[model samples]
Target: MSEGGIPTIDIEDFPAQMGKLREACEKWGCFRLVNHKIPLTLMSWIEMGVECREIIKVYAKAVHGVGMEIAGKLAESLGIISSSGESEEIFRDWACQFRINKYNFTPETVGLSGVQMHTDSGFLTILQDDENNGGLEVMDNSTGEFLSVEPLPGSLVVNLGDMAAVWSNGRVSNVKHRVQCKKGEVRASIASFVLGPKERVEAPTQLVDSEHPRYMRL
Candidate 1:
């Protein structure tokens, strides 16, 4: 829970938290989420599904679909959605990438990067980071420096991706992050990405009104 700048959002107080969520997205492009409706038991089930390699993708897609609804509501609070309440449905159509990464410690691979620095080239990513192991870091958009993201137990980290930036007409922040294996420990994380439309990605007309002109076409 030692998130230096990123705020922690309580989903139970969704309406109350929308403002904070919007600020987090606009500034940090990522935040720690708590009070999520999902139960710890379900999370354990997802873990089991991963181990069984049977229902991992299905479960990830279901989680991402729910996450997208939350995102759309957040967008609504910011007046960034379409004229009708269709943004959530539209986002559900986006391609999903469900993946789990395993970082195992090796004596020969000391001081190697687990993941290189890069921005998520999608709309959003819901990550279940390792509760014990932490090597994730995100770049500060203003300072041009990287900040370490510590592990928060029983929390999901939501990151706004490239398509989010474009869809929000540049109001949203697209975070850049990388991973390092600081300790000789095995770390595992699962992520679900919501890629943009099958046709083309664009900001909704409501988001590009006079007050907020379109920023990125794609």
Candidate 2:
């Protein structure tokens, strides 16, 4: 269920591993997922030329599906629909943003931060990190220490963001992560963000009570 202390969730196991998924969100705030079904070719930059835009289009569309799928599972893990029998549509009309990051690392930049530590602002982030370059790190909420996130081939990393924390009424953790320069190489990553649902986001009535009150509103 974990690789090097980082949670590893196999999406192929789905609802059966719902508890693990929820635990990953609550405890690790992020997880590396396998069997996501995205092709390896699309995970690359596609030569970084004239077809860059076209590749992005294809890649975005594919990652978008995975993003929505994860969003739905997260809601289900929260017992949103099963508890109320009401069709939860927190991801309905959600926005997907695609980003391709390129980091130029050098000897002088080694041991430096490629990006500052911060929590994502959206609901979830599906990241295809560089298979050859490993620099991403996530904080271990329990100890307040950052742990290196080693790249797992053919797997994608999912990070719970601020929106997830708000939607789950503090049940989920908004992870803090950063990218450091580990080597002098060109590091690239593709990320698909599942953002606002175009509707007010709030915890389900079932999650809010005298025992467990809502912690945030969006």
TM-score of 2: 0.92
- Tens-digit lDDT track of model 1 for 67-88: 7776776677667654225665
Model 1 is weakest, by summed lDDT over 10 consecutive residues, at: 45-54
**What's the CA error at residue 137 for candidate 2, in Å?**
0.3
Candidate 2 wrong stretches, greater than 4 Å: 1-3, 46-50, 83-88
Q: Give Cα-based local distance difference scores for all models.
A: 0.76, 0.84
Instruction: Report, for all candidates in order, the number of backbone clashes.
Output: 0, 0
**Per-model TM-score versus the true fold:** 0.86, 0.92
